[model samples]
Target: MYKSLILLLLNTIFINVLWSNDYILNINDDMTAIKVTICSKRPLQLTSSLDNATHYLSKTSSHVEILNGHQLRLTKPDSCHWLIIPTNTESTAMTGQLLKVPTGLLLWRNEQIENDVINVQSPKAANAKLVNHSLPLPKINHDQYKWPKEPSFMSLFAYFGDFSQKTLRISEQSGSNLSLQINWLSKTLDSQYDSLISWINQVARSFVATSVLSGEQTVQLNLFASHSSESVPFAMVYRGEGTSIDAQINPQASLSQLKTDWTLYHEFAHLALPFIDRNDAWLSEGLASYLQYPLMQKASVLDEREAIEELWHGIRRGQTNYQELSKPNLTLAQLSSNMMEFRSFKQVYWRGAIFWFQVDLKLRANGDSLVRLLNRFNRCCRDLNSIWQGESLSAVLDQQIDYPFIQQLVTQYNNSTQFPQTDRLFNSIGISIANDNQIKVLDRPKLNRFFANFKAH
Candidate 1:
């Protein structure tokens, strides 16, 4: 608790900066929370997430609370001065939970400011300042961390908005690197970043080898500090073709964690498909997760047996982390419903991967492969702006080849909690546990052929 600010309400002059907005965010000395004060000349009814359990606004009470409309109506009779403290140093990508991360970095915003209405061209804030920061975020030579480039859209999306912007600010700790930053040009790829991108290119070449997608691509790598060393706590891969393809990384992440983590390949695989809806995360995330393994095989990152092993582990992880619903059995329809109750994101990811795996196996049995189908899908809808859904995507995929694997999977898994069981698939490919508990290939002629044909050698 840094008690440096006073509760002065009389004769206060609001200092304005950046893009004409009177809002200014001052970092606390301890670097825990940011103090946001906006001196206004007129009355404004400020609205925050009052209904949310997490108020999102930590240091206030008098002017903010859930009422009839959940808006904090600020009646500025004479001089409207509002101050709110939004906690920034607590949440990080490493913990997956909002905890104190004391990186002294802030998400360039007055936490309560509405970015959607503010960042837009038509609805730009009336008096808001647009002092966006310069591009290629300057590198800070702090012993704690390093950011290779300037913050871009990803950072703005979190602090400001999703749509791309030209300028943003760090506000405090300019010379310090105590936080994570992911933007178009925020961080550069060196050891961990290089390894991840190399792996991506390897799989990408493999995908291209199958003649599915093109190889000429540009991906923006963003690195940030980590909260936990165990795994990458938070990451996101977004944007489409003609747009900057972005991937997030934790600079503090160990080489082993960075190399072994499937997040890179998983996100990288998403670039193969056109953008889909969040509700259909199963399709997008699942496809990426499943493809990562084979792509790893192409990169020599994981062998056939190791690929199967990874799939096995992913299945177990999805099963273990699956959120149980009221209906013990879930169908693809119920599972895909935007109704948050029936949705299990983990289940969707793995189960959707399993569906693809089973379909690929079945298709290969009938003299076809998943790569060919994906190639056709990519050819048909090459544009990212053209959003796709399950039905339309399935219809187009079926049109690609004689077999309709995507359609079949949707038909089978859309109604219940039937996740893919990889045991039989693995067994068919000669993957088995040896006496030492390591994965090995069984000496079966047919199985050897299955393994050989499963992935491009």
Candidate 2:
């Protein structure tokens, strides 16, 4: 009987310990306030991502105190709760009704929390818009909840108040799948909904067909109507516990205009590899620029000739920018590292693309291609959490295919002061530049066959 009693006591203690890391987040009726309950068995130290977190707090348990900027000390963690009333609920555009909850209030402990579960309770009404967050918030056991890998700042970003949601499930030829959740924050885009969805599907399909995405991935797309006149004003990809994209579109843009826009294509193309470090911005931007046209061509938004012409024009722009911005005694690596200070974006991006184009030509000459290499790399070495430097990325690619060209180019171009010469490379691939600087594709059998095979894949 004593043994049985001890066993029952131990089991109770174990359950408490396991549930201690769980959290309950109750979003108030108006969606302007959030109540956070920390289910802890003992005292804990908490950290906040937002420096002005105290300003948002309406009520807190007596045990909780602001120890410092972005730091919260919990003297008695048991049954502790805090009510946060956020005030930074401004929309990105003036005409948009979207009010984002300043829910960047990410809380963490001194010890890392694993398999953190957050139970979210929100008022359910037909007109009440569902919260759009970067992390997955699915209905689990009759409650809206999320299972985050760990508690971090990225997990805390969410927008509430006004939005329409749609989901697209895409399956590629290679069996890779993507569940894309799109949140339309701008009511002006309602008329272009179908067109926007179609365009997004096409771009996603093209990426998957090229083996840029492997396994199953979920992405959250937040669409906001921009004040700019451009078709797609801007777009950015955020990575943390998961991947999300924030895109701004013009309300007046047509479906055809949206499809032809390169902004979304370029943003999605960024998923081709692991996130490159900011210092190696050239490499990351270069891959996107180089792949954008081809991806557009593959999606039937642009034909082969148009893609080639775009590439040629882009290369010329890069070359021109390099010539104008080149500083004496400054290497490409130095320029790339300080590109923002020098305003050498075009040169950095174009030079990176030129390097890739040259590498592709060399690979094709050896009866291999960049696509094939990337397909292999995606199958083996794609890690969401990994941040790759230019040299490290090249080394990994070389390991996959036993090819030394990628690393060799990295070493050569990093120290070189001049922009990469692509005249020979283009000519070998059966491309030429006319006197007027227009791109002309010659009758090159191998090149034609390669592209034909490329399209088919």
Candidate whose lDDT is highest: 2
C-alpha lDDT (0 to 100) for residue 367 of candidate 1: 77
Give the TM-score of each candidate. 0.53, 0.83
TM-score of 2: 0.83
Clashes of each: 23, 0
Give the per-residue Cα lDDT of candidate 2 at 74: 64
lDDT of 1 at 217: 34
Q: Would you give me the overall lDDT of model 1?
A: 0.49
- Per-residue lDDT value at 180 in model 2: 81
> Which candidate gets the maximum TM-score versus the true structure?
2
lDDT of 1 by residue, 1-457 (tens): 2333432322133333222334334434332344444444444554332223123446553543333423454454333344444545233221221122211222222334432112111113543222121112222321111221111222211222121222111111112111223232332334354555444444445444434453223333344445454455666665421223344556566555555666666765676676666666678777887887766665567766677778777877777656444345656556665446655666778888887777777878787777666755655554433567776777777877775566766766765555555667766666776545466667456544543553321
Candidate 1 weakest ten by summed lDDT: 169-178
Residue 378 alpha-carbon offset, candidate 1, angstroms: 1.2
